[model samples]
Target chain A: MVIRPIVSGFPPNMHKVPVFADHLMLAQRFEHPFSQELGLTGFGLVTCLEGEAQFMINDQRLLLNTSSFAVINRGSRLMINVDETPARPVLLFFRSILADVVAAEIFHRQSGHDKELSYAELKDYRLTEYVHYTHASVKEVLEQAIQLSQSCASFQALKTDALLRSLLQSLGQENYQAIAVSARLPVVKQSTRVDLYKRLSHTKSWMDEHLTEDISLEDYADMALMNPAHFLRNFKTAFGITPHQYMMERRLELAKKLLQNTRQPVQEISEQIGFDVLSSFSYQFKKQEGLSPSQFRKQVTTD
Target chain B: MEESQWSKFKLRVNLNASVEEAYRCWATPAGLEEWFLRDASFKDAAGNAKDKNTLLQEGDTYQWLWYGYPDSVMEKGTVLKANGKDEFVFTFSLGCPVTISIYKEAGETIVQLVESDLPTDQGTMLQHFVGDSKGWIFYLANLKSILEGGLDLRNKKEELVDVITA
Candidate 1:
């Protein structure tokens, strides 16, 4: 495959650098009529500038509006087109090396694990997929990049590139999932609902932090500063489940993860998940997972 | 991250336009209305228009009444500093409190925004509020497109959703 860069002025060494590209670029919206094949070596980000664009990645058609951005997975086959206008989009390409180093440092992957480069995997890559910037902040980053790219000196552009890469990595999946949940809701101010939501949110965090404890409905109400009856009614309203049920469900989920990841026995797993009795733990695990503890472990290992 | 604490984020942009032009785009009722929204008005806490030096003065609070919303949002905070040509600092309130500083960097202006003293609920919510965060991410992209490319996405709200999801 002939190696070509859509933009000019990058160093020849940049072509061979093995990390995600840390630089800002600007491009008008334009179509690449010829399909491009990117191999597992690197990935790219295209932010539409003037017009609409379409990125066909691994058979999934992702449309890029003026502000819409899409991450092109490494080695993925893509057909990129600016259909609304002939102007091409500004593209930022990051080689896998940056992610590799980050994963090694933050996620602590074993030294020699091969990083998966498929589109499906990249979709779950929280760092690169979404950077939750305020509407104004996003403007600021793009505008800064544009200025730096157009600068007579390379210093600003280099710095801007570094900042951009860091920004991409900072956008974790946790943020993306939360934002996805918020955008789907109707815009209405329900004070009662909001208050209930506040309590539920508090309870969720409290539960996560106290997963090892013998938590009860009364304890949850105390955390939220509400009466037990009030807590139960509002918790149901906010989460569609009573506090006790929610806590149990979360505990079982944790138990399942522990069982799958750890070599601990069922009794230990049950104890770890706040269940005092091994039989009770076994029963609850079976009820939630549709399998006994040993059977679940066996299925996980074999699969 | 308690309700009493606040988080801050900043973005700087280099505009092809001049400082006054950019300032006008953000400051004036007419200018802010054009780029920010179709109907824009500035009011005080008691609901009155803010004008002139009062509009740009330190310690002065301006409430921006946006279209579709009955209540206006407030902007409070002293001007930490201002360069008539390209820089200024001000405090603003969204649903939460934030201090914003705007400055010009070379050809572009940088807006350093610090949203602090957020209630624990807001902070924790903001920390994990994925849906709100993503919306802001996309909205910021839209802001850049409008400012630089003269593209307005609000008009294409439905089509935007369609093509994006399609």
Candidate 2:
């Protein structure tokens, strides 16, 4: 696994600030399945810039695609995986110290009082569950943060603090409080759910890597350590699409890439992407994309 | 127009260090991080560094990250020349060529930097020339301070105002 760290900095001990930020790009293919266990010491804000990624936070499966954002509370156990597709993410880490500073500032502005607030008091308003949002405003702020991070201009730290404050304001405290309350009720069944999701997500990643190979429902179910019937139902429920449909969609996406990039004949391209018959490949291509494979190539080439 | 027709800005500072030491500060990643950038790494296309704790060579590329910035923000450039203990040239922001020369004068190291090949357009020339001139002046003073007084004057904190303004 080749992970390129674009920018990373951690505040020194005894510093006024308690924040660590990392921007990483995972562009290389992993020869072996790669996973990392992260025990976050601070609140984590992860923004996906491109491609797809899957992360398990406190045993809850979270999918991140382009412009997706996830906020993880401090002390959460997170398992992160880079999808076969290249994934780039910007991660901002801030400790409870910084959180307290922001909270105090907010409180002072509202009440005109400079009172000290504990982390426990902040907890009531903090996001406990790993929250995910696909909002445009979040993406815009993250983009600005990325730009400011690259600039050599002075006052970047001031700008970064403002951006962080803006992010917290945008994600209203009431919404997090509601999510935190609801997340507590599912603890009893969470272990099994975590196990099931982990296996299913692993199998799904396997399917993505082996898109050019023929795979069956039984193969994926076995990988998930479940019977085909149970696996089929759970997979559909977990991903909102049946395994067969998911595989077909992946194949069609690959077919589109091949059609656009390569000069191979339709029959060869179909076989290369695990389609045994040209007619079935062309039919699926037309069904998914309004144009046939050849038409897509011609249209894309002309454009 | 000939390359000589390009506008050039030069700045020189006298440091209480040897010529070799001043050159080392400019040529090595460790020296750069002390007073210039926050992080610096030099690597080849194969993602290998010849010596993890040494000076960069001609043709080597570098990625530089500044303090108090997001990890995703970095500067990348290739070393155009590295004359032993005397002169170094590299591409700065926006492909502008920068040359740093070190000389022993008056029992001190005089480090002179020249940034050339700026845009010839009247507006661009004024903006870049003026902006870079101010920036270099501040940074050179910072380099002198770190070398002489052993104090870093960078605004490493997020709340501090910028020293350089538009």
Candidate 3:
């Protein structure tokens, strides 16, 4: 294993958390404490900020080095033996209720829009089914929140809470997407055939930038330098759906991201993402998302 | 041509952490909540769900929760080989019709989360592919922050707008 320099220690008073809280200083030459213990319902998220160590959770064992983050969820039984005698593990433990509260509030906001009976006719998916983690931009915001938490600044705490909400909503969107797909519910509209083929010739970054615009099949065909009918047939031949379905799916995706990541009013969000008519936006969102905008916002607000 | 197939999205991440740490983060509960989400349970690779703390082994069926969708664990293929500390390949899925690949690079872990094998009939799947990738970008950012003594970034609505707009 490589020897990386240790950077810093845990946030002060982080150990004062209600759950199990402890800090250990560890280095390569130091010996570790070994034990087979079943922990309480609250588990710590342990990170080897620096140095090296080995930990065993149940039958699974792993070596923790610099920049490593591990969750010690509540109700877990594990054995630990540090290879590097003085290796330090910065641990933060909170009750399972914390996670539950986070999940419930976010889920409700993301999923609450489906109370209407007509909602039942819509598919069951949203936006999260396809992702597991977020990007650096989000992480940076989170880091800012933690830094803010340190000062007890009202603005900072507000900032932190806001960041947390965004992150959870992002997760909810992913979860919704997964459910929609597995239930055989229709997601990603079928009208985007031409755009799909055209995109095959483009890059992801480019498509992401242009997702919320007037991307008609003919326009996409022109962009690809192909005749409209030929583009249609070849696109169908390659992708299987029509150009329009493809566009709607892309639109739906943008809408989902906006719904999960932003608190913009439903009407503004609808227009920002290219839905010209509020009724059409609601109708299409219902068809693809299975929830109304207000319900989605309300559910996410709990976080 | 099947018109009802879902799309696939793939994301590659190179983390500053070790492979084992990354693996455990994905496999264990403590590690999952960092980059993944607050909800990390087990399920079969083929959509058959498994209970929490279920021993994860090659061929052990398991599924993972990704928002509202449950991940289907594909066949636990071989490690493709592990370099002891740095690099390893493991099997994870993107629910019903997609496959995912994870790899590690340098001090950073390169996770290639892929959701593939959707219908080719239209851009439906590919549209999903792009959108999901965008989502992954956000998740990966959150993961990096949490692991690096940063914040969880799970629920920052205003900041999210700032990031999106900026």
Q: Each candidate's DockQ score against the native complex?
A: 0.01, 0.05, 0.01
Backbone clash total, candidate 3: 95
DockQ result, candidate 3: 0.01
Runs in model 1 deviating more than 4 A are: A1-26, A29-41, A108-139, A172-303, B1-166
- Overall lDDT per candidate, in order of appearance: 0.49, 0.64, 0.45
Best by DockQ: 2
Chain A TM-score, each candidate: 0.41, 0.47, 0.34
Over A164-210, each residue of candidate 3 has an lDDT whose tens digit, in order, gives 44444444443343333323322265324323432333322233446
> What C-alpha lDDT does candidate 1 achieve relative to the native structure?
0.49
Best by TM-score: 2
Residues B1-166, candidate 1: write the lDDT tens digits: 4333334443344555555666655555565455444444445545556763333433334434322221211122333333444444544332344343455676575544444443344423333232223333443444456667887554323122212110
Q: Write the per-residue lDDT of candidate 2 for residues B5-95, one digit (tens) a residue.
A: 5477789999998888888888988888777878788886566874645877888888776665544445567889998779999987446
lDDT of 1 at B58: 39
TM-score of each: 0.30, 0.40, 0.28
Put the candidates in lDDT order, highest first: 2, 1, 3
Q: TM-score for the first chain of model 2?
A: 0.47
Candidate 3 lDDT over residue span B76-131, tens digit each: 22222234343333433212232334455565667565546543433324333443
Lowest lDDT sum, 10 consecutive residues, model 2 chain A, at A1-10
Model 1, residue B8: displacement in angstroms?
Answer: 37
What is the i-RMS of every prediction?
A: 17.6, 9.8, 16.2
Which regions in candidate 2 have their CA more than 4 angstroms from the true location?
A1-303, B1-6, B50-52, B159-161
